[model samples]
Target: MASLNVGGLGGYLREQRRTAQLSLRQLADAAGVSNPYLSQIERGLRKPSAEILQQIAKALRISAETLYVQAGILDERDRGEVETRGVILADPTLDERQKQVLLQIYESFRKGNGYGADDGPAGEGGTSSAGTADAS
Candidate 1:
């Protein structure tokens, strides 16, 4: 768990929006921000206020805590909600197919464990292992 950096948050949000198949216009509409402003924020040319972050979170259908993490306002320990299973999936060693499979498994585990879409618990067995799953 590390303190989030504002630049990191901006990058993460942009990536998340892209991964969700959302255009800047679409995400801006959802977040209730102007498309140009959202684009600027995504490009690291602007920093969103906490209130704007909250609105963006609402539009993304994710917890504001996620935005906080992105905005560098909170560390992982301060995350009130929003499980970050994708962090694990984002390892460079993982190919796109592997990422997809892991994401699916993680989502299934979340569902089986009574986790909400936004504030789900992370882990297939409520635990983490440092060992590599692949030798390559």
Candidate 2:
């Protein structure tokens, strides 16, 4: 795994906040963070936990996947999740609405399980999402 780009993440967050026209305090309030702590994150002085990232992503109305990639917690070029989405969209038997619903369900399961952009080889102790589903 690559070391995180904390400074880059901070810059991106700041940019997103500006684009949303939210003051730092407003964003911190929306994300359930302290103003000074959010400012520190903006200043690249603290490495935020994944939960904080999720909160910020939600508050900013941005996809957490993009933020994860920016934070180096997820690989940008990981194509397995992309491929899955593409396959769902490419299925001719399913209408676009059905495909969208399926994709949303798939994403919810992924989020619940803490899956990310990558689908590296599963460890013996860790089941792939498919395996987990099958076992259930």
Candidate 3:
């Protein structure tokens, strides 16, 4: 298990809150936390409980698991998947819909092929022909 990354988690939360166009007080009200407490959280001065994280995630319209992973509260089972997602999201050339589509396709392929962080394409007796083609 990884140690808690308070700074990373706080930065993530602050980014999400800003992206949502919400004021500190507004998010605090939505998450049922005091504004000063939320400010402390965003400043990396406090560690929020899982419940508070969930509430904030809900207010931000994001997945609680994302916050949990950022906080290192949960062990990420698929680091590759997360990395792929980060790359896609960080691409400036892709719009939101494009990013979503790409992520959907990537996840579908991974799921259909049983690929995971620890499992290569040819996992469990399966053969990957991704880079191979027959010349007729």
Candidate 4:
């Protein structure tokens, strides 16, 4: 996914915090970040890394991938795949190698069924970057 500067992500974080009935200071403390830093993030004056976003998401009890999508760290079209990968990566029982192997299997299955990395889910009218039908 193409990385973008923070703007919508900041606003979205603010909304999520409010919806969770949390104040900036409360969320900052819960997320183990400084209040000022979190305020800067909410004001769009800062870009949070994926780790920081994950901490904030945990504090808000929301999906980290949602913030990742808002921050442009992950593409909306790839949200589901990325989410599955995230869950696999975060599993306590799976070792690194197992996680990687599982991910590879998942990728192969998707590609085998005409859902390659570049292709959307079925019935999405897969198109190439050039805006043409998928040649393969």
Q: How does candidate 1 fare on TM-score?
A: 0.53
lDDT of 4: 0.84
Summarize candidate 2's per-residue lDDT along 20-126 as a digit string, tens digits. 99999999999999999999988999898878998999999987777878888866745458657868999999998999889878865764464533454345333
- Per-residue lDDT of candidate 3, residues 4-81 (tens digit): 888899999999999999999999999999999999999999989889998999999987778989888865655457
Cα-based lDDT for every prediction: 0.69, 0.80, 0.80, 0.84
In candidate 1, position 21 carries an lDDT of: 87
Give the TM-score (vs. native) of candidate 4. Answer: 0.71
Top-scoring candidate (lDDT): 4
Total clashes for model 3: 0
lDDT of 4 by residue, 1-136 (tens): 5676598888899999999999999999999999999999999999899999999999999998889889998878888987888899999999999998888778776765657676776667653333322333
Query: Judged by lDDT relative to the true structure, which candidate is superior, 3 or 4?
Result: 4
Every model: Cα RMSD to truth:
12.0, 7.9, 8.5, 5.6
Error of 1 at 99 (Å): 38
Model 1, backbone clash pairs (residues 3+ apart or across chains), number: 1
TM-score versus the correct structure, for each prediction: 0.53, 0.62, 0.57, 0.71
- Score candidate 1 by lDDT: 0.69
Which candidate order results from sorting by TM-score in descending order?
Answer: 4, 2, 3, 1
Instruction: Please say which candidate is ahead in TM-score: 2 or 3.
Output: 2
lDDT of 1 by residue, 10-121 (tens): 7888888888889999999988899999988887778788899999888777778878877777655436323455465558998889877777666565445554344324
